[model samples]
Target: MDTLPDPVGSSQMDIETSQAGGTPEVANSAAKPRVRAPVRVEEAPKFDLDTYIANYTGRTRYDRLYLIGTCSPSLANEALKAAIAEAKASKDIIKYEKAVRALSEVAPSDPEATLNSAWVQETQRSVNAQTERLEGELKGYKNNLIKESIRMGTEDLGNHYYRTGDLAAASKAYSRVRDFCTTPNHITSMLFKMVSVSIERGDWLSVQSNVHRLRNSQSKPEDAARNEPKIAAAWALAQMQQGAFLEAANSFLAIPADLGDSYNEVLTPNDVAVYGGLCALASMNREELQRNVLDNQSFRNFLELEPHIRRAIAFFCNFKFRPCLDILESYRPDYLLDVHLQRFLPQLYKRIRTKSIEQYMIPYNRVTLDAMAKIFAPSVIGGEAKPTDISSPFVQELIGLIQDGVLDARIDMEKGLLISNQVDLRSEVQRSTLENFREFNQEAHWRILRAQVLYHGLEIKSDKKFGDGGKGARFSREGAGFD
Candidate 1:
């Protein structure tokens, strides 16, 4: 995010968290509000639950499925069912219970929603026994003062804590392992734990910090290559979460290809494409979009996963604004269901639309309001639901953009056109020249004053006039002695 380097040949990347192993651990305690029937509604998300889930493995599968279930009522039953199956296969009873509870709310008749007390009890016992055993082993390692053993032991405990959904405990355990790390791999492993904890906890700042810590680590070249895509994706995720869209775009674009399914525990290649493409469209200009997006060889592989994003970018680059926007709108519902993207989707779309409008007017002195409305606000124009007038939403948006200095065009309601406030380059250059000359003259005067003072060996000294206790004495500089 900070560097926004080129996608290919960049050394920066991201990876590993509590679900750092075969299973991911998230905060099971943080309750979420349940969403009503998602698929049952007329506005169903176009996202395929099975296909999206296929991109991930380990604990993230359950985490994402649980999120989809809770948030999208249409997908709730299917998502929660898959989440339950994942939890059943794992020892995370807290997660199992949560999923079961949520499912019961959504589909009480579904047998999977019925919490299995026996499984919960058995898992609880297994977890307790494992925790005690790991704690004992960690104590023995600490007593022996074995750095590697202690580090491993701490990580085990941390992973266990993570699995049990003890987020605070897991974070603490992960942090402790850093003190005992003895190698680059060790440091990398420890940093991954920290990143995972922070990610699951929604501590984006901490996630970025850990990513930088690893990015700056002295890992072997081969290992760094293996982990680069994920860390970069993770960093970009943090950047996106923090509303640093353009910075996030650069980080996402910087992620190399050939990652395949290796980094899917947190993010899929499709995520990289979707996230990077949208952000680039929203932030980057046409030239940047062309060079960094459409022409980016490394990112091209990721773009292949979602050809729609590629088409959107191509459409945008080719000045086909309405088609580009239409494609995005068609996918909005599905994108809205994405856990990381939902919060920023509205902002991203708004930015893309405004930028398109801004770009559309760049070559023109003026455009008819009708033309602008059709391109930017087609739904609101000439519809009984929204009156076609100066007071309409499209006009309001234009007004806001104009007022905010984002658009250099203004509405000429009398003529029904948006007129560009074009600049006279000759006058602008003359004005710039005058300002520079004034600045130089002012600087020159100061320089002369300083030179004269220095030449005269100016020094401050108190000169007594005729006053008690030097009260009447004033400090004066021995100056150029001007007559």
Candidate 2:
């Protein structure tokens, strides 16, 4: 194998030539470099929202903590404990203070109990120290810086106090920031917070004023969208408190569900059902209930939450008197607990019952006293026949409905029957048309007579007052009057 190689394929010659710093002959074809495959990144382990939110701290944690605490007390307590521990371990005074106040909201107890807790006591000490340091820093600043500091400090204090459920203190603090807001959005946000606190305190006048500010503020599109739901809900709440049911119902119905769900902390879907249903029942007519309430798809969704309310409305729409009243009567205890509804429950019930009675009588030419009693009388298990006399309360109620024009029918006391007062439209129209024709004929006859007399060169004379002097006037067919 040690024979001499070909000159063109001389491997030894090439090796020797490369060693002697001479270029070697190379093949024209070359292999391509291999491409390494891209590394695959595994998807981040599924995020746990509960665990993620537990890390939230600062003043923003108050509302989130409330929601979590209500839904899962143990998780909220764990999160609170972790925050408190971290705050103390790191010596973060603000975190420790907010965490303690948030604890008070989650599990409210006696003042002494909260004050006696070691963590709360430590938070209080930190708060005092911070306040002293802040005051010391305030004294060294110029007037402008001092005013700016005070303004920022007041707003921060207001937010802190609001989170701690001290509405009065929060309101005072917020009031001091009014003169310092530089932008329209800042002013609007401040007023909105003020309105919220005023609602909590039931100060309707203040709420009205602040809500007015929010409405009149020049807000950008995003800001307006963010604030509209709150404005509508607050206005509706005020209207509800004032017993303006129709206004409240309309307002509540106008809110989008996505936005309205945010107010579940204040008003539940069940409350919406009660408020909207009762208001509509009290104010709307049978046709209106059928058109605006029962048939309205959006409102129907809310009514679906309370089946009995939906059923009651359905019964009323179908003119079923006993069942509608029965449904309302059965749920009377539930409605009584609602502070706003309780005040007007009796009146609303009376109105609904009266409307049902009116509807029941609509198709009848004359209904017997027994039939009226059978419908309006309280429920009986065995369906016993109750002989209702002409003097029964139901009869008097019908008479009242008649008087109120809620029912176009009258009670015949002697005959023991309800007589419908509904007029036949065809007959009424024919009679009216005939009367109009007769009047037109009489006027034409008089005009023809006057025209014939005028054609013969005669003028019509009347002794009626033409002016203040009560002078008589003569008239020709063309209505030319000469006094």
Candidate 3:
């Protein structure tokens, strides 16, 4: 530019010269490239695993231990193998301890397994300590349940013994309950059972003592009342048996009105009639008997409606033959009269048929004869009355007429009519009429039939040969079976 020297030719010469030697631009470019602050690639601080592991010692110690072990499994396994080899090589305790310590230093890989192992050890220690406490509590609950069950069983056993009339057994059972009972109600119930057992055993002093205890004890009124009647009835019966009639009557009269009503309502007709009759007999008051009879609707209803029952009662109470015979004739019951009816009939017949009795007399069936012997034989005859005592004087008189062939003659002479025309004689037209009587008096028949009706009456039995032979003959032991 200074001389602008030959412009283009000068520039060409400079370029040629620069190319011959290293050009200034090439030399400058080669001068270390101006060292532009070496572009720093900052490689994220080389991922310092040691520092990470160290930081986690307290916070994630288990995690750090797992990571170290997993990352170097081969190294850790090799270390364990070497330790095991050393332990196997030498049995020295010191060597073993060293191997165990070294192996323990290699942390467990599973953090959860390590934590679980520690937790299990701690839980085992606590469980061992608490087991005794829990066992004691469990034993207490078991004992309570066992005691309750025993109480229930004892109560039931006492009740069973009482029903079966095993007073001693019942008392023992009740005593067991009382001994173990923890509750007042249980004690009271046991006391009541004791009292009832005493009454059934007829231990009057014990009954009185128990009753007094029951009165003093706090109990339900209904329960107390339920136990009182039987005791009172038993006491009254005992007094009556001892010939203390007035005292016994007073005792029976003292029975609560409600109790009497309950008895009347609950007892069967026969039971009510029998007990009412006993009460009347004890008091020796016809009015009381009538009142009891009327009060018991069953007895009154039967007497009013059942002619046979009425006939039985009439014969039993009045010993009147005409009324009873009239009632029996009117009813015409298929079955024969029971012993209570048969016993009075003889006396009734003698009193009513003294005049022209042969005409009015009816031949006695075997059933009638058996019943008569059972009912009245003891009282009238010196020997014990038996169901088979058909040989009484009154019965012999009737049987003699038939045996002597004078029944028809006597009937005709007394009534001035043919024997066929007489109502009383018409019933015995055939000897086979006695067959029903024989069957009715048979032991087997009475055992089955009377057992069905009375449930507990008539212990007689027809002889085995008679029953087996189909003869239908019956017989009974002598004396009153009650004694």
Candidate 4:
């Protein structure tokens, strides 16, 4: 077997011998192939590209790019290629810029090689210029690089914009936040945000739609506790906007104090008070107001936000007509200017006034006109208030209510009193029963008489026809043969 020459020591000795003037050609011939020691380069730990990118939330996009570009040229190339492919597929200029920048950093030119360092720098500069040109496109893409984070972050940013009153921009930003929410709470939160935006834009239909979503979602207990009041408030506001006062009032009253206290963005506590109080006054009876509004602990908590409204409701429920009207009158300006309450104010006040009249007269057989006027009239606050007379608008309104059957009483102008139209239940029932019985008896007598007439008429006709000479009549009675 042929052996290989020693390349290390022999090559050095041949150089020494040739320098020492020994025959140069013989020294060179005597030199063996140098066997160099094996190189031991410490390889860097390989980066798992899939694992790194999979966990990447675009927050660290630039950082990751720097790490790959500086530490691992191969991984940088892989990242760049992946980014390029994504950019092309998605038509994202930001990703394209990222790819260019990464490539320039990863592959710098070597001067000793055919491609000089200056050429490399020039190429890098060109890539950088292109990247800078596309940098403006990168502003929104950072969040979007990671799907989940983007959705939530976009929602937060949308809310910020909404709060700042950039409504159009806010809506546009929110539209980009797709509802990829995983939990019920998250879904409800998304819906609430949408509702808030709708409310801002006065898009009541959209608000109601989102409110429906919030209502149907089954949130966690904590989330429900946190979110239910806001949802209720939004629903009530939307209903009020639509002039569905009855439903809106119920929704407002349903909001728990804790939630109501926490949520003031859409409806203040005072607004809730006026809304619920007025709605109850308009649609519900005194009994309902007592039961559903004044007596309800949760709803009362909300009303406590505006104590006067609560007082008004209590007064109305307790049949203090004058006091209730006074309290409502005091808040007239506030209610008049309220976005939700203003539209309903006049109707609501009228209902309260009518109810006051009805309830005031409920137990009385007769009330003086002066007394009725005193209860129904809005009293002047500061000066000596005039005694409201029968000819006043207050009395006129009461008269109208009575005529409309809203108040089941009659005003006697000559007697100068309000007379309650009381019907005796027992007497009415007995009279109705007696009338029915008499009608039934007459009907039975008529039926009997008509039957008798029909029977007699038939009998007479038969006798006349069957007088002994009538053959047709004679053949029918006995079992005789027809001749």
Candidate achieving the largest lDDT? 1
- State the weakest 10-residue window (summed lDDT) of model 3: 1-10
- Winner on lDDT (3 vs 4): 4
Q: Best candidate, TM-score-wise?
A: 1
Total clashing pairs for each candidate: 14, 0, 2, 4
lDDT of 4 by residue, 124-179 (tens): 45544543443333345553575566666666655544432334545666666645
Which pairs of residues collide in model 2?
none
Arranged by TM-score with the best first, the candidates are 1, 2, 4, 3
Per-residue lDDT value at 93 in model 4: 28
TM-score of each: 0.78, 0.57, 0.28, 0.54
Q: Is candidate 1 or candidate 4 better by TM-score?
A: 1
Error in Å for residue 398 of model 4? 3.1
User: Given candidate 2, what's the lDDT at residue 421?
Assistant: 81
Cα lDDT of model 3 by residue, 5-43, tens digit: 110011233334435784332221111111111111122
Candidate 2 lDDT, tens digit per residue, 149-254? 7666667766655554445667876887878777788788688778766754556678778877888888888888787766777777677777777787787666
CA shift at 280, candidate 1, in angstroms? 0.5
**Candidate 4, residue 134: how far the Cα is off, in Å:** 14
Q: Cα deviation of 404 in candidate 1 (Å)?
A: 2.3
RMSD vs true structure, all candidates: 12.4, 27.3, 48.9, 30.3
Where is model 4 poorest over a 10-residue stretch in terms of lDDT? 1-10
Would you list the clashing residue pairs of candidate 4? 7-33, 7-34, 7-35, 8-34
Off by over 4 Å in 1: 1-42, 385-387, 424-483
